[model samples]
Structure formats: C-alpha cells, structure tokens
Target: MDMKLEVVILPVSDVDRAKDFYAGRLGWRLDADFPIEDGYRIVQVTPPGSACSVIFGEGLTGQQAGTLHGLQLTVTDIVKAQEELASCGVEVSGPFRDETGAFHHAGDARRVPGAHPERASYGTFAAFEDPDGNAWFLQEVTERAPGR
Candidate 1:
C-alpha cells in the first residue's frame, strides 16, 4: 500500500490576500478557488514541479494564521531560488547553511553566512514567508537521496 501526501491546509486571515501572495507573487499554479457556502471558501495552489498542493481559505482550519512554520520546498539552486523570490517582491533570507551539521534552526545562532563549502546537496537553503507569515524554506537538493 502506497500512501501519497496530497495537500496541506494553510490557515490564513484573508482569502484574497493569500491568493495574491501564492498565485500572483510566488507564481504558484492556482488549482482551485471555490466558495462552498456562507463564510466558507477553499483555495488550492501547487508549487511548480511539486506533487503536493496547499489549500487555504475561510472556515477550514482551526490553526491561526501566521502561526504555522517549517513548511519546505526543494530546489536545485538555492541562489537562483532566492533571487527569483526576491524578484517577485518576496523578502528572502538566505543562501545560508547549517554550520553545526545538526540542523538546529530555531534561530540564527546555528546559521552560517553562506552556502556550504562544497555546494553539497541539501546543505544550503533559503527562506521566505507568505502574506500571512507562513514560513517556507527552500532546500537545495541537487540529487535525490536513495530512491527519492
């Protein structure tokens, strides 16, 4: 039995604003945006080349907006990804690496200034946030680890 992760629910304060950030600013593909009934709506967006999608809107999740973190996306080039996001008017912070190799990323204490010395796969990363402050990390993964 193969179970696949399909979608992640995002708690957002405003539906249109979040839509603009995800679909307009970040350039993710807008899969759906439908109002179910009164005070209820659902919007789905998928990052390019990703199998999983993200859903956000009204009356869906109990989690507070701007409180979710640790959502990550994989990229082949950290620098390029950061540049692309900055070009899209998104505030990006990185091209940095974990210095201790322990991945302790609670704050900036364990973070180094730049990418890994050898540009190692999964060694470097970048980050950005949505309009609702949902944090997303861009991990540089040049090659898949053992069967992906």
Candidate 2:
C-alpha cells in the first residue's frame, strides 16, 4: 500500500476573499475556480513549485472557515520568504535563530525538539496567519535527502 498527499482542504467563510488572499497576496497559482451545486464554489491554489495544493470552498459539511492550524510550507530561504510575505502585508512571526544554527518560530525558541543542537529537522521556519485566521508556517530547508 502506498499513499501520497495531494491536497489540503482549507475551510473559509468567503471563497472570493480567500482566493484573493492566497492568489493575489501570496502569489500562489490559482488552479481552479468554479461552482458546484448547492451554491458552493471550489477554489484551488498551489504554491510555486509545490506538490500539494490547498482546496477551499463552500458547502462542506460541519466545516467552518478560519479554523485551520499548524499547516507548514517549506521553502529554501526563510529571510527571502518572510520578506516577500511582509511586502504583501502578511505579518511574519520571526527570523530568529536557535542554538543549533537554525532559525525557527521565535515563539518556540526555548522549546526545540531533542536538544539536537540543530534547528528543527525541517530547517528554519516562521509562522503567520491568513486573514481568515488560518495559521500557517514557512520552513526553509535544504534539498531533501536522497530517496526522500
């Protein structure tokens, strides 16, 4: 059995606003935007060079917008990424470095995993939230290990 992640459903109260935030502000590529029955709209956006995309729309059962938390998007440069997002008015949490020579969420500076003397295995990262209050993280990592 094999499984691969493809999409993440981000619940939102307003589809168009979310679209503007992700696509217009964040510079994600808008892949799809159409309507489904029951007056719901399906909108999908993918980060540049990313394998997984985020899906958000209406008519989802028991789903409320702005409830997502702890989603991470890894990149190659934390400072550059933070600058880009800040340029677009996104509030970035930090570019703080830990004792392990890695930068991570300043909020978690004191509580790194395993005392590995290195940043999180994923690399340097930061945190931010969308207009809908959906929390997200940006990680800066080197190239993946072979066979990963």
Candidate 3:
C-alpha cells in the first residue's frame, strides 16, 4: 500500500493568532476556516508548492502550544528562501552549516555561521517559528537523490 503524508495538526493557544501567522506572515495558502460546535474551530494552511498542509484547531490536540519542533521545509535555494521568509516578518535565521556536516538538531550547538561552502543538498538550513513557537526549518535541496 502507498501511504502519503497529508497534514500536521499543530497545537496552538490562540486560533486566530496562529492562523494569522501561518496564513498571513508565512504566506501559506489558507485552505479552510471552519467553526464547529462548542466554540471549536479548524483552520488549515498549505505552504507553497507543497502537497502536505498543516492544521490547528480548538480542542483538536493534547499537545502543548509551542511544543512542536523540527518540522522541515525543502527549497531549491536557501538564501532566496530565507530572504523571502524574513521579508514576510517571519524572523528566519541566517543559513547555517551544522558542525557535524549533517542535519541540524533542535538547538544552537549544532549551528555555525553561513551556508555550506558548496551548498550541498540537505547541508544548509535556516529556521523560523510560528506564533506559538512551533519551530520550522528550511533546508536547501537543490538536487534530489536518484529516483526522488
């Protein structure tokens, strides 16, 4: 069977604020905003050119707000992606190369200044967060592995 990942449900403290940050600041396409019973609401947003989307809603999750970590987005150009996210008021960090020359972890210990010297795919990244501090990483993957 083929299984495709579709959505991630982020836990947020305030629905409207989180919605604004994802849909407005990050410029994700607003897919839906539906109000259900008992004052609950569901909001869905999709990143540009992505098949997957993220969602958040009242009463939808037990996860704490700001606890989601290390979600990643891939792009062809790290610098351009960082510039665009920063321009959108997203507070994106400068692209960095991990000290281990591999994927980065959740803290600053793994980060060093500037993009990878050769701009190797999956080697350079920048980071940002949503309003409730759900961290997201932008990774540069200029060339995919064979058959990807």
Candidate 4:
C-alpha cells in the first residue's frame, strides 16, 4: 500500500488574511475556495512544485491559530528563495546553517550566519511565518538521498 500525503489544514484566525498571505505573499496557487453551511468555508492552496497542499478556513480546524510550527519547504537555491520571498514583502529570516551540520532547532539558539559551505542537502535554512504566526522553514536541498 502506498500512501501519499496530501492536504494539511492550517488553523487561522482570519480566513481572508491567511488566503492573502499564502496565495499572494508566498505565491502558492489557490486550488479552491468554497463555502460550507453555517458560514464555514474551505480554502486550499498548493505551493509551487509541491504535491501536497494546505487548507485553512472557517470551522475547518479545531486547533488554535498561530500554533503550528516548523513546517518546511525545500528549495534548491537558498539565496534566490530568500530574495524572492523578501521581495514579495514577506519577512524571511537570513539563511543559516546548523552549527553541527545536522538538523536545526525550532528556536533561535542554533543559528549560524550563512548557508552551509558545502551546500549539502538539508543543511541550510531560513524561516518565515504566516499572518497568524504559524512558522515555516525553507530548507536548501541540493541533492536527494537515494530513492527520494
């Protein structure tokens, strides 16, 4: 059995604002926007070149807005990715590599000043957030592990 991950539901306080941030600021494609009964709604957006999508809307998730953290997006060029997002008015963090050349922490203490010198896969990252403060990270991956 092969199971492929699909949609992730983001809990957001304001539906319209989240929509604007993802679809406008982050440049994700708006896959769907429709209404459910009793003022509920469903909005789905897909990041470019990603098979998975994220959804947020009224009454869609029971989790608190701004609580989700450490969601990741992979990029090939860390510098270009940071520049593009910053140009779109998003507050992206500067690219940083882990001190140990391994996984980084969700907090600020482990950050080094620049991308990995070797440019190894999964070694460098920058972070940002949605309007409701759900954090997301951009990781630079120049090579995939076997079978990836």
Candidate 5:
C-alpha cells in the first residue's frame, strides 16, 4: 500500500482574515475558497512549491477555532524568509546560534531554549505565528557538499 500525506487542517476564527494572512501576507497561493452551507466557508492554500496544502473551514471535525498549535513550515533560507516576513510586518523572533547551530522564532523574539546544535545540520531555523496565533517555523539547511 502506498500512502501519502496530502492536507493539513488549520483552525481559525475568521476565514477572510486567515485568507489574507496566508495569501496576502505569507504569499501562499489560494487554492480554494467557497461556502458550503449555512454561511460556513472552506478555504485552502498551498505554499510555493509545496506538495501538501493547508485547509481551514467552518465546522472541521474536532477542531475548535483558535485552538490549533505547532504547525511547522520548512523553508530553504531562514534569514531570507525571516526578512521577507518582517517586511510584511510579521514579528521575527531570533537568529541565535549555540552549540546546536542556530534557531529563531518568526513572530516573537525568543529562542526556543534547549535546541541542540547537532539538530541543525543545514543552515538554521526560526519560528513565527500568524494573526490567529498559529505557529510556524522557517528552517534553513546547508546543501550537502557534493558527495561526502
């Protein structure tokens, strides 16, 4: 059996605000947005060149508005991604490097304590949160130098 992860569901209070944040601020492509019934809406978005997409809508199963947590999105360059998000008025947390390489946050300026350096073999990583308090991470990794 071949199985693949396809979509992730995010909970939000307002669909329009979430749409603007993911699409307008973060630059995620709007995949779908429409109403299903009784004024409920369904919205989906995909990050640039990503296989999995995020889904948010009214009345999702076992998901409460503004109750989601710890959804990480990886990026190629942490610094560049942080800069871009900062330019869009999103608060970026850190670029701190210790024995465990470097890590940061996207929204708040705080280093996630106890992050080991060996965990970061690539470049570095950071985190941020959307307007709805949805947390995300921007990871940077060094390209493997040819063949070791």
Candidate 6:
C-alpha cells in the first residue's frame, strides 16, 4: 500500500486575496478556480516543480486562516530562492541556521548569520508567509538523504 500526498487545504479569510498571493505573487501555477455555488468555491495552485498543490477558498476547512505553520519547501539554492520571493514582494526572512554544527536546535538557539557551514544540504533555511499568515519554510537541499 502506498499513500501519496497531493494537496493542502488552507483556510483563508478572503478567497480572491489568498488566490492573488499564491497565484500572482508566489508565481505558482493556478490549477483551478471553480465556484460551485454562491457561497462555496475551490482554488488550487501548485508550486514550481512540486508535486503537491495548495487549495484555498470559501466554505472549505473550518480551521482558522493563518493558523498553519512549519510547511517546508526544498530548494537547491537558498539565496536564489529567497531573492526570487523577495522580488515577488513576499516578506522573506533568513538564510539562517543553528550554529550547533548539526540539525536544527530548539527555540532561541544561536543562529549564525548566512548559510550553514560549507553550505551543507538541509542545513540552511529561510521563511515567508502567505497573505493569510500561513508560514512556509525554505530548506536548501543540494542532496537528498537516502530513501527520502
């Protein structure tokens, strides 16, 4: 048996605003915008080179908008990715990493400026949020761990 992740449904306050942020600002591919009725709708978009998609709109999930966090996206170049997002008007923060010389540490850990030592894959990170404050992280992964 196999289960493959396909989409994430995000609760958003304004459907058009969320749609604009994801599809217009982030440059994600707008897969659909279907209004099933006067009060229900579905909007879907997929990030570049990502198999998973994001869905948001009216009458969807009951969770509060902007409540989601810690969602991560893997990229080959952290700086380049941040630059792209910044250019798109997304308020991006970081290219930071835990100074522990290993995996990330707990809250308030010492995060030295810039990318990780030797630019190790999966060590460097940056963050941004959607219009609804749904946070997303960008992890620089030049090489993937075995079986990932």
lDDT of 4 at 71: 90
Regions of candidate 3 where Cα sits further than 4 Å from its true position: none
Off by over 4 Å in 2: 97-121
Cα lDDT computed for each candidate against the true fold = 0.88, 0.77, 0.90, 0.90, 0.71, 0.88
Poorest 10 consecutive residues of model 2 by lDDT?
A: 111-120
Which tens-of-lDDT digit does each residue in 1-148 have in candidate 4?
A: 9899898899999999999999987789999999887669999999999999999999887899999998989999989999999898989886998788898886767799888888888899999988899999899998998999
* Of candidates 6 and 2, the better by lDDT: 6
Candidate 2 positional error at 40, Å: 1.7
Indicate whether candidate 2 or candidate 3 has the larger TM-score.
3
What's the TM for model 2? 0.80
In model 3, how many backbone clashes occur? Answer: 0
Per-residue CA lDDT of candidate 6, range 19-136, in tens?
8998998889999999999989999999999999999998989999999877889999999999999999988878888787665554326866688978988899888888888888
Which run of 10 residues does model 5 get worst, by summed lDDT? 97-106
Q: What is the per-residue lDDT of model 1 for residues 100-126, given as tens digits with 9 covering 90 to 100?
A: 763538655688878888988888877
lDDT of 5 by residue, 71-129 (tens): 66666666677788899889976554333244443344444443235545443556678
- Can you tell me which runs of candidate 6 are displaced by over 4 Å? 100-110
* Residue 128 in candidate 2, Cα distance off native in Å: 0.9
State in Å the error of residue 86, model 6.
1.0
What C-alpha lDDT, on a 0 to 100 scale, does residue 8 get in candidate 4?
Answer: 88
Candidate 1 lDDT trough over 10 residues, lowest sum: 100-109
> Per-residue lDDT tens digits of candidate 3, residues 43-125?
99999999999999998899999999989899999889988987888788868989899988676677899999988888999
